[model samples]
Target: MLTAFLRVFAGEGHPVVLFLDDLQWSDAPTLELLRRLVTTES
Candidate 1:
């Protein structure tokens, strides 16, 4: 699933912006994915 997301973003030609709301209510898996995305992309 994370690979799929990385591919989607990486394949895009234009800049991307992901808007996530109510992070306090986010579940553990979601937060973990976000962390990985940030670390991997940066």
Candidate 2:
């Protein structure tokens, strides 16, 4: 699911911008998904 979501922005001519807000209110699963994305992406 994450890979599919990321592929939406792959191989584009324009710049890709992501906006994440209200992380303080995010649930554990949501936060964990973000952690996984950051770790794998880096």
Candidate 3:
């Protein structure tokens, strides 16, 4: 699900910055998802 979401902006010819608010309150799964998103960029 996260891969599909991030892939949407992978080739849009523009910069995309995701501001994740309240990150400290996020769950482990959510953090893991973000880690995968950042490390798997093409």
Q: Which candidate is the best by TM-score?
A: 3
Lowest-sum lDDT 10-residue window in model 2 = 7-16
Higher-ranked by TM-score: 2 or 3: 3
Evaluate residue 38 in candidate 2 and report its C-alpha lDDT on the 0 to 100 scale. 67
lDDT, candidate 1, 6-36, per-residue tens: 6666754754567898999999999988888
lDDT of each: 0.73, 0.73, 0.79
Q: Which candidate leads the pack in lDDT?
A: 3
lDDT of 2 by residue, 11-41 (tens): 4575456699988899999999888776665
Summarize candidate 3's per-residue lDDT along 1-42 as a digit string, tens digits: 868866777665865678889998999999898888888856
Spell out the clash pairs found in candidate 1.
none
Q: Which parts of model 3 have CA positions greater than 4 angstroms off? A: none
Clashes of each: 0, 0, 0
RMSD of each: 2.8, 2.8, 1.9
